[model samples]
Target: MSHKIIRSLLEGRLKAWAAARSPALRIAYQNVVFSPAASETYLRAFLLPAGTNSNDLAGAHRLYTGLFQITIVAPAGGGTGAAESLADELAALFPLYDRLTKTGFSVQVMTPVEPGPEQQGDTAFALPVSFQYRADTT
Candidate 1:
């Protein structure tokens, strides 16, 4: 499948996660909401093609590298650690090594490149997460 399809799936998963925590966290960003207007909560999932090389079609199938960036944003109210709480809920949605697969492509692994940020600033919390997945575009 194309990267666009994969991205849509990722967005769906993110929205589903937020919906599950609507009552407690009140996640406002069902999609990737990035705005200065500011209500309270926001989240965005961005996917980019990191790099692609021949994984060898000689075997049976062809594999490609698909990297994605997931950024979760939340309000930073007071010094009361509101952002951290949001981060925790967000983390629960995408646990380590979560496997996401679809037709014509499959994510063999989802690995975090770096530690997710707990807080971005005094106004909002940002969790920047990266993952590399292997896609079989056969």
Candidate 2:
């Protein structure tokens, strides 16, 4: 499968997640999947308020909002496993994170990962995830 499919999936997933919590920003993530041939890669999702300066991306900021990063790697023939893990992580945060951030708050996930997919039953599976969030402050 091409990386574009995965990239689009990740962006849509992240946008839906941010919208649930921060309707004000109306986030639309930009995809940055690298090395299409690589089996594993990192995708970045950025959140910016609507009407944000197109020319001045990053603008000016003194505050150090914590960075949130989630990294998940699935073995060969396990793309579905990776996607599921990402879904769960966002699902857990979409509600509370939005409420907190709407009030001038900021948070970021530091490191997120999990073991390879674990089979529970003939038609079931479980994936692990590790995540971190820190409030942004200047």
Against the true structure, candidate 1 has what lDDT?
A: 0.58
lDDT of 1 by residue, 43-132 (tens): 556677655555565765555667665665666654435545655555565666776666645464466544365555866767666667
lDDT of each: 0.58, 0.38
Candidate 1's displacement at residue 100, Å, is: 1.9
Best model number under TM-score: 1
lDDT of 2 by residue, 1-138 (tens): 112332333345465655564222232134543432234323334332212122334654332322333333333454465557455765564433332332344343444433334434333233433333334332
What is the lDDT for 133 in model 2? Answer: 35
Model 1 residue 4 lDDT score: 62
